[model samples]
Target: MLSYSEQEILAANVNPATGLATDYLNLFNEAIMLFEMGLDMPDMAEELADWHPRGYIEHFEKSGFELKDVVIAAYEHAPADIRGEFDAACERALTMFDTSIRVLMTANLEDPAAHADLSDRLRDMKGLVVEMDSHIHGRSPAQKSLQSEVDALF
Candidate 1:
C-alpha cells in the first residue's frame, strides 16, 4: 500500500473529476491514484479487474447497483457535454510527455556529481512506480503494460 504522503502527492497531481494533469509527471501520478483507489476498494477492484467494454456495458445494464457501479457507468457513458473531456485530457498528457522529454534533454549536465544524483532520483522514481503498479495489479497484463511504460520513462 502507498503511504499517506505518497497518496496525497499522487492525488494532488490531477483533477479527480476530469483526470487532467498539468504535466507529464502528473499524468502518471493520476494513473497511480486510479490504480490505488481501485485496489483499496473491493468492488472497485473487481470492476477494474474485469474491465472491458462488454463487462462494463453489462454492469451498466444491471439495475439497482452500488455507488461504485453507478460512478463507473457514468464515467463510461459521460454526459454529451463532457464526452470529449477525457479525449482532450489524453491529448494533453501526451503533449506533456513531449515536454518532459525536452526538459530532460536540455537539463544542466555540467556537474558529474549532480548527474549521479539525478540518476539516483530517477531510479528511485522508477522503483516507486513499479512498486505501486505491483501492489495494485499484481502480475496482470495491465501491470506489465504499466511497467513497460515506466521503464521507458526512466
Candidate 2:
C-alpha cells in the first residue's frame, strides 16, 4: 500500500511515450515502498532484497531538488495529526539517502572495509526507517517536539 505522496509521485513520473513510470522519482518511490513493506512484513524480504541502492542516488543526482525540501513540503501539506510522523520519516529518509550516496561513491565494493561501511550504513538506515514506520502507524507525543525542531531547520 503506497502512501498518498508516493502514489502522487508515481503518477507524476509517468513517461508519456511509455505510459509507465520509468522515471527516476518513480524508481525512488518504489524503493522506499519496498523498504517500508519489508519492515512491516518480513514475508516481502525476498522482494526487498533485490533493491539497488544506486537507483535512489541517481534520482537524487538527477532531480536537482534536495530531499529535505521535498520532505518539508510533504510535512507542511500533511494533516496535523500525521505531520509529526511525516516529519520523522522525512528526517530518516534523508539520512538514508545520504548513506546511499556514500555507498555509491565508494569505488571499491570488493574492499572489506568499504563493504563493511556500506553494510553498517544500510543496517542503520533500516533501523531508522523501522522507527519512522512506527511513528507513521501510530501517533506519538515525542513527534511534536521533533517536528518543531524540523520546522526550525527550514
Candidate 3:
C-alpha cells in the first residue's frame, strides 16, 4: 500500500491517479529531440551517440526534481496493471531509441532511404512515448480535469 495518500502524492507533483510523475517524460523528450535534429542535420548525428536510456526512477534520482522521493514511492505503489502497461511502453521506446542510434552510427544519412527509415523509426518511437504518456495521464476519460486541477496547484 502507498504510505502517502493520493492527495499527498498530488501535492508533490506526482499524478495521484496514475501514480506517475511527468518529469520522467522529459527524458524521453530529450531523446526524441536528438533524433529529430539528427534526421534534419547530418552533423547532429553525433549528438545521438551521447543519448542513453534512463529509467523513470533513475531519471528522478539523477534530476533535481524536489519531489523525487515522493514520486518514486508513488510509482512503486502504483497498481500492477497500470505499472505493467507503462513498463511495456517504456521498454519498447528504449529499444527503439537504441535501434535508431545504431542506424545513425552506421547508416549514410545522405541516402534518402536512410532518412525514410529514420523517419519511420521516429514516428514509431513517438507512438510509444504517447502510449507511455497515457499511463501517466491515468488512461481515464475523467483524468483530464483531475490532471488540470492538479496542475493548477503548482
Candidate 4:
C-alpha cells in the first residue's frame, strides 16, 4: 500500500502545472482513497458506490494505475505537432481498461451470481480493447473491425 506522502509526491510529479494540476491531483487522490478503502474491506462496490462510480475503485486500485495517470498527464502536455491527440485517445482507452479490470475484479469476488455477469462484461470489454491495439496501424479487414469495436468501447 502507498502512503499519503508517497501518493502526494507522485501526484506532484505527475501534475506539474499549477493551472490544471488540481484535477489530476484529485483523480489520483480519489483513486488511492478508493483503493485503500477497497483493500480494507472486501465489499468494495458497496463501499465506493456512494462515493464514486462502481468500478472506479478497482480501476484505480492497481499498482500500475498511477503510471497510467502519468501517461495521461504527458499526453495532456504533448505538443500539437506531435501525436498528442492519438496519445490522449490511447490514455483514455487505458483508463477505461483499468476501470474494466477493477469492475471484473470486484465481480469475481462477489458472492451474488448477478455480479458474475458484470465481471464477464468488463473482462470482455478489456480484452477486446487491448487486443485491438495490436492492429491499430494495420489495414487488414480484421484490424479495421477490431479498431471499430475498440473505438465504440472507448
Candidate 5:
C-alpha cells in the first residue's frame, strides 16, 4: 500500500521492506530512561509521571522527529497484518509501562524489594522495545514474546 519511492523512505530512515521506522522507538527510550533513573533519584518520580502513551502516527505528529510526515505516511501504508501485530505489541508495551508508572508512583523506591520488582518490570519494557526495534529492522521478530512478556510483566 505504501507508494513512497525506495529512495524517499530510506532517506527518511524508514526500513523499506517493513515500511517501519526506528524513530518511534526513541519515544519509548525516553520513558525507560526516566523510570530507570527514578529508581535511584527519588526526585525523578515527578518527571516520570508525566510520561504518557501515544500511538505511532500520534507519536510522530507530536514529536519533533525530522521525518515525521514520512514516518506517519509509511506507518499508514504498512501491511495490515504486520501493522496489526506491531500495534498490538505496542499497546501491550504501552499498558505495561503505564501500569509500571502507576505502581512506581505509589511504591517506595527506597525499599529494596519494590525497587527490584520495578527494575525487573522496566527490563521487560526494554525487551519489548528491542522487539519493536527488530520489527522495524525487518528482522523476523518472535512476536509471541511481545504478548507473553506483557503477560509476565503486566
Candidate 6:
C-alpha cells in the first residue's frame, strides 16, 4: 500500500523527464486537498458559493462529494455562470480522479504491463488540466484588453 506522502509525491510528478513546475504541483496539491474537503462538508451548496477553485468544487460536488469552504471561496471569486461551469468541471475531474486512483491502486507495477497501464492512467489526468486551462484562459484576451485600457487610464 502506498503511504499518503508517497502517493502525493507520485501524483505531483506530472512529467518526470520535463520536471513538473512548482506552480503546477502546488495547484495539484491544492486541487486534491480541496477535493477531499469538498467531499466531507455538510452545507455543500452554500459553501460552494464561495469556493476559490469554484469550478473544481462544483465538479466534485456534482460527483456526490460534500462541499466545504472551497465552495464558498469559489462563489466569492467567480461570477454566477463561471461558478456553475467550475462546479461542473470539478465534479467531472473528481470523478475521473477517483476512478483513476482505484485503477492505479489495483495494478501491480512489478509487472511491466501494469506499469505501462499506470502511466497511461496518469496521462489521462492531463485532460482534466486541459479542461481547466480552457476555462481559465478563455477570458484572457478580453481581460488583457481591459487591463491595457485600465493601465493607460492610470
Scored by lDDT, model 1 comes in at 0.37
Residue 39, candidate 6: Cα error in Å is: 26
- Show pairs that collide, candidate 3: none
Question: Which candidate, 4 or 5, has the higher lDDT?
Answer: 5
Question: How far is 112's C-alpha from truth in model 1 (Å)?
Answer: 0.3
Pick the lDDT winner: 5
Per lDDT, what order, best first?
5, 3, 2, 4, 6, 1
Quote the positional error of residue 115 for candidate 1 in Å: 0.4
Superposed by TM-score, candidate 6 places the C-alpha of residue 137 at a distance from the truth, in angstroms, of 4.1
lDDT of residue 39 for candidate 3:
84
Instruction: At residue 143, give the lDDT of candidate 5.
Output: 53
Count of steric clashes across candidates, in order: 0, 0, 0, 0, 0, 26
Model 2 misses residue 125 by how many Å?
1.5
Cα shift from native, residue 38, model 2 (Å): 17
Off by over 4 Å in 6: 1-77, 137-154
lDDT of 2 by residue, 25-79 (tens): 3433455555444444545534644554443234445555534333333434545
Model 6 lDDT tens row, 1-154: 2222433433532222221212322344444434333333323323333333323334334433232233333334445565456446556766666565554445454677866665564455444555443344343223444444232221
Q: Which candidate has the highest TM-score of all?
A: 5
lDDT of 1 by residue, 68-153 (tens): 33334334443433435334433444444334333334444455664555455444444444433332222322456644556423
Off by over 4 Å in 2: 1-82, 139-154
- Clash pairs of candidate 5? none
User: Can you write out model 3's per-residue Cα lDDT over 11-94, one digit (the tens) per residue?
Assistant: 777878778877777776777777788888877878878778888888788888877889999999888898888888788888
> On residues 37-95, what C-alpha lDDT tens digit does candidate 4 reach at each position?
45435566454453332222233344355454543444345345333333343465456
Evaluate model 4: give its lDDT: 0.41
Model 6 lDDT, full chain set: 0.41
